[model samples]
Target chain A: MAERKVTVTSEVGLHARPAATFVQTAAKAPFDVMIAKVDGPPVNAKSILAVLSLDVEQGDFIVVSAEGEGADELLDQLVEIVSAP
Target chain B: MGQVPTAPPPTLTGTGVSPGIGYGPARVLVLDVPEPEAGARHDGDARAERERAEWALEQVAADLEARGARVGGEAEQVLHAQAMMARDPELATRTGELIDRGVAAPRAVFAAFGTYRGLLAAAGGYLGERVADLDDVRDRVIALLTGRPLPGAAEFAAAGSGMGVTTPFVLVARDLAPADTALLSPDAVAAFVTEQGGPTSHTAILARSLGVPAVVGCTGATAIPPGVPLLVDGAGGSVRLSPPAHEVARARRVARAGRAVLPAVSSTQVSGSHLFRRGMTADGHAVPLLANIGGPRDVESALAYGAEGVGLFRTEFLFLGRAAAPSVAEQAEAYRAVFEAFPGDRVVVRTLDAGADKPLAFLPPSGVEPNPALGERGLRLLRRHRDVMNVQLAALAAAATKTSAKAQVMAPMVATAEEAEWFALACRTAGLASPGIMIEVPAAALRAADLIGAVDFLSIGTNDLTQYALAADRQVGSVAGLQDPWHPAVLDLVAATASAASGAGKGCGVCGEAAADPVLACVFVGMGVTSLSMAAPALPAVRAALIRHALAQCAAAASAARSARSAVDARAAAEAALSRT
Candidate 1:
């Protein structure tokens, strides 16, 4: 499994447009992708409802993980989206 | 039936949140989306009911996307996100499961949404607010299933059609939900009148952003029958119902003339227009008009509105919403950008002002106090965290060396001359020039001469001065009326501060909401305030007002205002004096 921990820097955190874009990107992955708060249970990253329910805010840290080829590239893309202002 | 002669409809009054005039037919927004019955059950065939629920959600999602495409920009992004909520897979699955258990489609959808609503509401703050958006989506789906018209659907459709309607509507409502306003544009809604809302309400903020005239907290506004000709004066806070044809014509003529007199001034054409290029009185006393900005992002609007320079460049933006203070290099980069925007012009940068309403995560207070407002904040917070203050000062010094902009630094919430001296010495050590201190505390204003002697200049923050002098908490709504800077007591403090700065042969500037008021701008100049700075959008009006009156008239008006006992009387006296020769 390829995993990366990134901080959400956008003022609204992982919600609104950012959450929608995140979920849409995860849906494009060939295999299942998972996301969770540090030390929290993982949930399906492609589910918009699950991501929003996490209620992640600005300055929060979250872990994204995926297994298979191209997993590193996908995780890198997700990290860029969350960290961009 | 023949037309019967009747008395004129009564005029309704409310607080004017946005400034403009609008005349149009009343279109009352009815929010009557009924909740689906909880015990409702589907027929024996659960599969058909499940398909019906899925179909309804899909239709609502497609409709939202269509409206979003028509209203491009920020509104479009909002509608698109709402559409996502409508087609959420989790929502669809939950509804399908409920339908399989013999629950009706409408009831199943409602229950499914209710679960998410509870979770968002429990999360509070920004997340809590999203519950409203979720509820809006749920209401739309249920309305479709029950065969009822979606609330505000007609207005949304009209706004999205983009076919310039013959006469725009003056939307009258009890209060508008975000969904109702997401698709509305200025062309479709001439004005907005609501029965409940204050100056800071969502409706007021949205109306101002869209530049649409709006009146809020209007009693009897929703009672007005639809299609009645309503004339709204947003500045005057009056809504005249079924006004005479002649009166409406005259009002429209006046509004048109006002617009013609002050077309939006752009930076490219500012040099060509002599009247707006500089802030000067009729007698030609120059008082440079500046803009109060948060950071570099605001430079474009400030330049667009022809800001001569930056009056109050708040440095707190760099420190806010962060785990720690930004590095010196990062801070210098941000400051340099702002300084570069206005080459050869003054840029007064206020140091990190966090505490009270705005507390930083890294910088904690010494102890818990009964009142945070009166506790250690601003300069006091920086004093304890000297490393933080030194880094900021070094960054300012570094940025100033790289730009031609005349960078000036100041400390906020300085109560005594000793604090002013301490801050000034620190700036001098860091090689920053002309360090000043804000006169927000009553003690600072009362002993302005002593404090002014310690700094290079003085900037009067009238908002905090008013709050401190009148013993009124600015955050409390009930005490908001007391927060008026026009109060004679607050005016007295301003006069003292400006006089002290002048006595010390230093510049004095007013950088508060009070300066945005054109009439008050003139009065500040009269009280010996050498400069006026406000939000960029208010520059044109203040410049226009200043150029219409001479320095002597403004002084007389200031004197007249000081003699009055109350804020209302003071404003009236000043207006009366300025009107006279």
Candidate 2:
């Protein structure tokens, strides 16, 4: 499994346009991807409803993990989207 | 349309938030999306039921995407996000599991959405607002499964067509949600009449922004069957159902005349016809008209409406929806933009009015109280967090120094002479030339003389004053009738504050929805209010009304209104007094 932790840097946090972009990208990945806050249970990354329910505000740390052929590449892309200013 | 009624059409009254006249066929928005029965069960074939549920969700998602594609912009992004929620994989999986347990498609979808609903509602803040969006998606899928017309689908379809409905129509509803009005266009809908909403409600604000005539809180608005001919007078707050031909013709003529008087954007020539250039009475009482603006973006409209200056420059925009307070330099730049727009004119900047309904993430209250409105807010919150207030005052002073415009600062929700003195001293310490406090609390108005001695001027925020005085929440639709600023009690408070300011020779201004009403504007000037500020769109009519009446006539109207017992009676008495030229 490829895992990475990234702090949400966007002013609106992991919501609105950022959340939509994150979910759309994760949905396109061939492997199963999951995400959660540091102490919260993991939820499907491709599910906008689940990701939004987590309510990860700006400056909060979130962990993303995926296991498959392109898991590492997908994790890097997801981290880049959340960490972008 | 609905068989010309044999009876004389009834006239419904509501609060007029936006001013104008419109006559059109009524198109009532139906939002009766029924919930599925809790125990509703599918047939023995679970596979077929699950496919039906999945198909309905996909259909709703596709419909949302198609609508988003049609209206491409910021709205498109919101609709796309809603579509994503409809297609959430976890949601589909959960629904399918419920269906396999023998629950019907709609029931399964409802149960699945309910689980996430609880989670989102618990999260609160920005995520809490999204609960509505999530519910919208869930309702749409269920609406599709149940074979019912989607809520707001007709309105969106009509708005999708570039110019709007083939014939303009008056939209009637219980109340409008954000999704219901996502595609609303000014040209498409002639007017708006809602059964519920106060002057500050979403329907009122949206109607004002669209420049459409609107009447809210009408008793029987939603009961009016679709396609009935209706005549709406937004200023008079009247909706006449199935009006006679002559009445409709008269309304049309009045609307045309109103449209003709709009101030030309490029004209600098001030003549008798261009009366909106200045605010004065028929006998030459100079009461400057200003604009109540949210930020720098509204400066152009304020200028277009011939505003002398900005009466209320709400600084909360800079602090809201952010994790931390903006840096002093960033705040200064924003303030400077507004000051530069009206050089040589006074821009009254209101310090942060956070707390209560508008709590900031960085500045939470010391403890949760049963009532936030009466709790730590405005100056109370600032006193506890002096660092935030000091930074804001420093920004205002820096911005004022950089521009030719005079910057006068004020504090909101100040309730005592001591609090007013504290705010005034803070302003002077920061090098701000003038400091004032808003008379939004009855306590401040009752002791206005003492409060006036502590500050340079007084600005009455009638919205809050009415809310506090009558013990009515401004946002609650059921108590909207009591939110009228024309109530004798509310007017009495205004008179007290204005008289106190006049006695001390300090400028007293009104920057509230009351100032937007033409008749009320005249009465306010009569009561010795030196200035009136409101939304830019309302400037022309108010200027015209003021120019037609002398200061003595306005004073007579003011006294006549104050002698009345109820808000409705007060308005009628004032109109009668003003018309006796």
Candidate 3:
């Protein structure tokens, strides 16, 4: 599994609109993607509710993991969204 | 429920909560979802069960999307978010996992949603509010599997698609749940008819705020046939079945003329418009008209109605339906949301008033008493759980620092001076400036002087006060007749509390259904109550009523009402006195 860690930069955090946008992007990929608060169990990245329930706020670090073809590309995109200020 | 087309349609009478006239085909709302039997296993084929769950989810998602499209605005956005929730991948995956474990599709869906509901509820703030939304989605999916009318299905279909009843309809129901009314299309609903509800029920309040005609507490309303055209006379509190065309036209003509006089008052308009003015009686006695809101979302309506301040900010939204009490930070954030809305204005917040009608699953009193209403509730529960009270006060105090809004903290169900004093000290300890006690119990009202001496202010909750004084369960339909704030006994209590507050030179306010009544509002002011807080929609009517009557006229009405023999006589006397003036 490919993994990357990114700090949430959106002021409203990784929930609400940001969470919806992240899940919409993750749902488009052919491979499975998961997101977790740093040192926390990963939840399905494609699930808006699950991503929101993570309660990831700005300045909080989250670990993104995925496995399969194009996993690295997916990780890069998700990490960019998370790290976007 | 069959439609009877008699020559002259029977006119069923009820209590009119909102005033308007409407005519349309009936759209019955079914909100109750039968509990899925426990331990029901799916057929051995996990794939088939998964297919069933997926189908139900897709149907619900499509319905939500269609409704969102129909009602374009903030409501549309909320519905779109609900659609995303309906199609949540985590929920689907969990349901599949449960099916794989031999659970039936319905039970699997229920259990899967339960996990997320608890998580969201426990989060306890913005996320906590979404738990109700998730429950709506869950109920819809389950209803699809069981082949039942989805809760609010009639209205959703009517508004969303052209296939269902395309015309606007009169919404009839036993009662409406928050989920059913949350995103309703005001244009699609002609009026509201419910089997049970008072002037203070959610249905009445929502109807009035939306400017839709509503008649509540109508016996046999649920039995009205679906799609039958009915004439609703909101002012008269009557629903006429299959009315003659001429009769409907006359009603419409009357409504049109009324609208001509009050151009700002319409079924779809909400702003206070021409009525937006400072709260004062005809003689310029300043009695600030305020709003009673459940959360920050309601602050807009309060402001739109020109509320001087928030008189009762019920904090139960933070605690209701949650697995645990909200953390101090979460509570502070919620409080701040409301506080920031009314800078420099008074925002009186009631500490969590749970028990009886509204019980927190987390706060359990020692064994259930046969009657929970009289059991541990309000200040009693908070006293037993002192930590909860302290944390809430601390949060309020912290939030007050962020905004210029004058935050006054109060305790509900305070029956004694000691309880009032205890709450007052607790507020001071938490650094909150103003501490108050709710005058809900008869004992508290009777001993208002003592309680007022112990607290900074007194706010009367006439709903519970009437119930306790009359010995009628507010929730029981059979006893709803007895739950009348107009009762001389209840009036006496209000007069007692008001005089006590006046004697002590402290502010007193009435924040309940009683104060919402335009005529009664004047009476409360006459009795020396300094302020009135009620649902935002009621503000305009109450203000107009107050402006029509002078201070002396109001005082005369109050005394005349007090001298009346019964609740009926009290209302009559007050009305007669006002009319004579």
Candidate 4:
């Protein structure tokens, strides 16, 4: 099991569409994916409720981690997604 | 309603904004102040305490004077007033009296603050009761506070707050707040005259919506007490007490004559040829300038301004100020009307963005409120209130088939790649075309390359982008300097979104303040923003600016603007481009 902290880059943050997006992407990944507010603990990314619990806004740094193949790339993509601009 | 209308009231002397005399009515108004509770204990110990409180206030006042001597303007006055409260002898004397009575420090301060504050408030209360003359209230107030009789109304504006009116009278007030505007019955009041309020203040918004003329920042406005003949020229931002008979006669004549001419634009001004031409830059470069309308009234306004199209049709207002959900049929009728109004123009309708700051009157505002800016609004609101979203979608889908106008639906406050997918899926299920998301969130910008693929077009809402970018409110003066569109952070975000959309051969436009700013117009145009939507009135200047600058010059201008520190700097850099060939 692994987790990497990342920021939410979308203008509105991770409360709405982005949170749902994270859940969808996390569900597609090979390993169990989780995201959390940087100041908080990791939670299931697939669950919209859990993802939103992160309260991630644009520029918020949070951690994303998953176990299994391509988890690193997944984290990288998630990071890119969070800190886009 | 009779006769070709005699000349409007003569040109009235009022305050000046940029400097100019304009004719308007004599709006006599009284001020409304919150009434304070009565009853209190007055004694010697209380006197000593009051002295102490006065001393404390003096100290604060001294401190403000010291600081104000160095810094001036609006900020100085703001700080100085606070200092004045601190220096006020009454505040010190009252507090001291309470403290001597064995009251705790906080309690003593509050108690003292209350008693003395109450005295002034009582006077204000008395003034409110009289509503016509404040001289009586002023004398009683000054005598009570300073133990000295006050002067006459010769220095009237200095005596007390100004008068207020709900009817068609020149309502002179020290300031106009939300409450003040609320008291103005449209039928009774012809216009608003305030000694204070910025162009962007709520008072201004409300006043404009009511079609009432307004003048702000009038000095010594309270001079014209209620009933004493005075003229209020809101257009000139001035007030004159007892204008000579000649000036009054001249005003009435000019007003009657001016009535024949369109004094100002109306809400439904989009009907004329002024809006007929494609809203483009002077140089032949086309930039769509759409209007973000609220409802029928705004639609009427948009059409009046000849808005190219409705970039954002906010659906939230429909759910608010109403008891129940607007049914699919009702919703369709409205949407159809909008589409019908602009047969060839595009109407990119945004789904209900009602949650957080904007709650649905008919439904439970998604209880998810810790951080509404980052919470369920826009698409999430739709998911939470699917029935509402479906009804809107169904309406739009049906309306689309019947109307001549093009309808492209957009979702707001979207944050992720998958959310775009959901929006796409939902739009498809509803049989709607050109479904997209508002890339107002930074995360959405990061996945822009992918997100744009999920939608047909992109419209970046820069207002929220700037807020989330610097974690600053648009209204806070202290942090206003940092709320720059040119900030590397913001520019980078906008650039990324633009780049992604461009790479995918998709269209992207910015429909925020920056888009409509004359100075930033070229910069945005350079950034490849397909359309720039702003307040309708801002169209001409922005159009003029765009026409002066070429597209090739725009890219470099954007880059130059990107390096600027604030909006001011960005504007300077953009303006610099116009100076050249």
Candidate 5:
């Protein structure tokens, strides 16, 4: 599994459109993906409810982990989306 | 059930905040969605119950997507985003989990959303706003399960129905949320009547901006049965339920005449022959007409409608909804865009006016405030976050050097001479020469002389002045009648501030919703206001009204209005004086 921690910086954290967009992107990957608040249990990244339930807000750090052929590339893409304003 | 008796036709009165008249079939908006019965269990068929819940969720999601497809642009984007929330896989799984526990579908769906709602509400500000959108989705699903029609969802459903209303319908509601109102257009909703909200409420403001007739604070507005014809006299603040046919005919005639005159005054494109000139009274007193703009995008319309300069450039657009403040260079570029729009003209930029009703995520208020209207906002927030103010001032200074337009910066919510002096010194230190303060607070207006001594100029935000002067919350519709700028007490403050600015040999400008009123614009000029800044579309009417009267006439009207006992009386006095001259 490839895991990376990044801070959410999109002002509204991962709520509403941002969270939905994030999940839609993660679902497109052909692998199992999960996200968790720092030191919290990981939830399915493809689940909008699970992503929102984590309650990741701006300036809060979260870890993204996935196991697949392109796990490293997928984590990088997810990190970029979460960090960009 | 017993047959309900036909009640006598009633006339509900409210504060008429927007002008004009409209009549159409009442389309009462329902806002509240009741929670399903708690812990209500389904029959032991777990598989069947889960399938029922899934079907409702899918139906709601499909309905939202259909609405989004029907209403393109921003509304479509918002609706489509909501559909995603409806189809949230995690929400479905959790809801299924609850159904498996023998909970009813509606209760299960409600409980599943509640878990996420707590987290978002705690985050506050922008995230807090999402809670409403989330609740909206939840309500739609629950409504589906309970076989009840959703409130705001009815409009979309109606539009999707093949047999929608051919004529625009009158929107009647207990109150309108700004978010919901943003999606409605004048073409769809002919007028607005709300049981709550004052003249300064969001419903009233949106009506005026959309050029729709509106009555706010209307008693029992929500009781008007949907599909019953309603005659709304927006200027009179009255709604006649099931008005006589003859009355409707007469009102339609008057409304037609009113509409015919509106385009001549509002649509600059339609009146292509209309010349753009400096704003002046008939007696040749120059009252510079300026536009109150949100961002650079509004400049074209402002200039098209003959805006001599930018009067009040609200910087909130750049700061709101952002996780972090923009870099000085980025801020300067945005400021430069507005300056470049009007070369050799004045652009008075108001520093970020966030807090109270318009809170920002990055700069949240310290604690829960009982009354946010009285909380630390505007300059007070900047004072706490000095770096924010410094970067903004630096950006303004940088932009000024790159453009020909005269750049003037002002601070909002300044209460004392000390704050004025501090802001002035900071602007000077940041290499900006022109620094001013808004006279919004009653304290600032009362001691305008001392503050004017510190700053270069003064701008009166009558909206805040009226709210502060009358001790009424601008956001509260119940006390909206008290939030009138025409109140003698509010006029007294304006006169005091203008007189002080005149005495100090500094320019005084009016840059609030009050300036948009053509009659009040003349009153402002008579009170020694050197400039009037308002929304772009309102410029032409104010110009025409000013050109129709001389300086002496305006001064007389202003004096007459100032002596009146109440807001209504003051307005009548001003109108009588202006017409008599």
Candidate 6:
């Protein structure tokens, strides 16, 4: 189990394209991706609306976590995708 | 269950399609399309190296074969019969042979496919005139290439009844693809609800046809899942899930039982309501009241609303907002079901109106302008996707023959008279009886006179016309006021379009939002429009308005409104005149 912290840096917030793209990327990977609000229980990474419903917008610090063989590597990539400012 | 059984509420409101009222228990049909496959990859060899090189070749043949299979049941043995080419063993074997030759799977598939397709075309003919066998061949080729027959909707049949209860209910979903939406049973389902679909989604159109009720674009539908004890009243666009016992009891109390139904009384026609008969002029000329139906659920509403017939039965809803296009036979079954619902009445179907305002991911995204009003859409999209249009028209034509209804095929977003002619010609070639055009573009309205001969009928789509005329963005809240159809300009366009149809003795109908308003019925009549088609619930008010008034008065009101300088002035004057009637 590993956790990666990244402040969502996509403009227009994580609700629209960024959120969808995030879910799509997460869903594409084999490992389970967990996304949550700054201080909330993580929701499934594949559900676009759920991720969006969390209301994690740009400039907000959010926690990304994963549990799998490549947890660290996967978290790094996920962080990279999320942390692009 | 009674020598004198009780009934449900005297009134039920829903997303009124085709404006009629049917006081029956909710028949909830949850239309659902199959979700995209779980496995997907971006920038990866989802396929092995052997399958990558000739992706083009294998893809094309596969596309055509899949297309053939998809088109199978749409209309007749003719159009979709072309889809049988998917099952063509030689085509498959040849393409497979190409792949075995080290040319790569994609190229081998595409290369062999290309040759076979050329043969089908050289011998079978082009889109409009292609023989049945050839068309199916093309469909199969495309279907195979696309991997799936374009992402569309389907049906969602609940596994079973819980609590030994067959209570009338309305089914709701996020959105239904065409395939799953097909599973919706007209007899069992009362209504439909969806959160993420537009007016053009197949589920919406099916709801309109089944005469069931549907409310789409609700968006938060996962919250309303299957097996939930829920109550939906489409007329009100509201749903009460797990209602209190009293509410269920109240709904049951208000429910009108017995599908056997009472026979029509001679007085029933004249006494109950005058809306179904298209409003009359003070002079007593009959006006057609057509229904602007989107899905099967709205069919019942359309009939109830006193719609003389369906005026704008959008066909594109079957394919839009999905992963891919629909097969011809798949489209045919849906079309047949709609036309069948309104037997003997006129059901004017517009070909798929995709692109601009509505886009499909499967198609290469043609660069859309910041404001799509000026971009390519409607007939332009049809021109580009001739394959889709051909199958749709063919399905409509086939469905018409099967349903025993007067199903006239038409085109959407016709900007030029030539476009009308081309669409009409496509319809005719497909064996559809009437090839008509929808007058949504200002250009069509301006040149209505020239466009009449090109079409069997003319339908005034006032909603878009007003938007375009006023340069208003329909989605923009600031410009909401400008979307008024009563604008003298929109009315004049209707009048002009009507006049054009009248001269040629072609059918003229207005199935836009303007037609649904009770106050505007008279004005539409006055404008020389042959019919006023609208959503079903508006029928009662529209019928009452028409019955209470006369055609001469409506014409007079239209004239005064038309003389107004602006849309605002025109609406004001029209409203005042309608109040008097």
On DockQ, the candidate that comes out on top is 2
Question: Residues B421-478, candidate 4, lDDT per residue (tens digit)?
Answer: 9888889899997897788888888779989888999998877788778787543334
Chain A TM-score per model, please list them: 0.97, 0.97, 0.93, 0.81, 0.95, 0.84
Give the distance in Å from residue A70's predicted Cα in candidate 4 to where it truly belongs: 75
Clashing pairs in 1: none
TM-score of candidate 3 against the unseen true structure? 0.66
List model 1 lDDT by residue over B1-581, tens digit each: 11222443579998887778889998876554677777999887899998889899999889888877776655566667778888887788899999988899999999999888888778764455567668878888888998865656557557646465678889888786443564465688889998876654557645754567899878778667778989998878999998999988998888778766664432233445655579888888999999987677678878987789999998766775344578999999999999999999999999998777666645767766569889989999999999999999999999999999999999999999999999999999999979999999999998999998878899998878888999987555456678789999999999999999999899999987689789999999999999998877678788888877999999999999999999999999999999998
Q: Which ten residues in a row have the lowest lDDT in candidate 1 chain B?
A: B1-10
lDDT of 2: 0.85
Candidate 5 per-residue lDDT, tens place, B220-258, comes to 777677788888888899898888999999988987886
Query: How many pairs in model 5 have backbone atoms within 3 A of each other, for residues 3 or more apart or on separate chains, i.e. clashes?
Result: 2
* Residue pairs that clash (backbone atoms under 3 angstroms), model 5: B197-B477, B198-B477
Please give the RMSD to the true structure for each candidate, in Å. 8.2, 5.9, 8.9, 19.8, 5.6, 18.8
**Cα error, candidate 6, residue B70 (Å):** 21
Clashes of each: 0, 0, 0, 68, 2, 124
In angstroms, the error of model 2 at B19 is 4.2
Better of 1 and 3 by lDDT: 1
Reported per model, the fraction of native interface contacts reproduced equals 0.52, 0.87, 0.61, 0.00, 0.52, 0.00
> Each model's C-alpha lDDT?
0.83, 0.85, 0.82, 0.60, 0.83, 0.60
Task: Identify the leading candidate in terms of lDDT.
Answer: 2
Task: Between candidates 4 and 5, name the one with more favorable TM-score.
Answer: 5
Each candidate structure's TM-score, on Cα atoms with residue i matched to residue i, is 0.64, 0.77, 0.66, 0.55, 0.78, 0.53
Q: Which scores greater on lDDT, model 2 or model 4?
A: 2
Better of 4 and 6 by TM-score: 4
Q: Predicted candidate 2: interface RMSD? A: 2.7
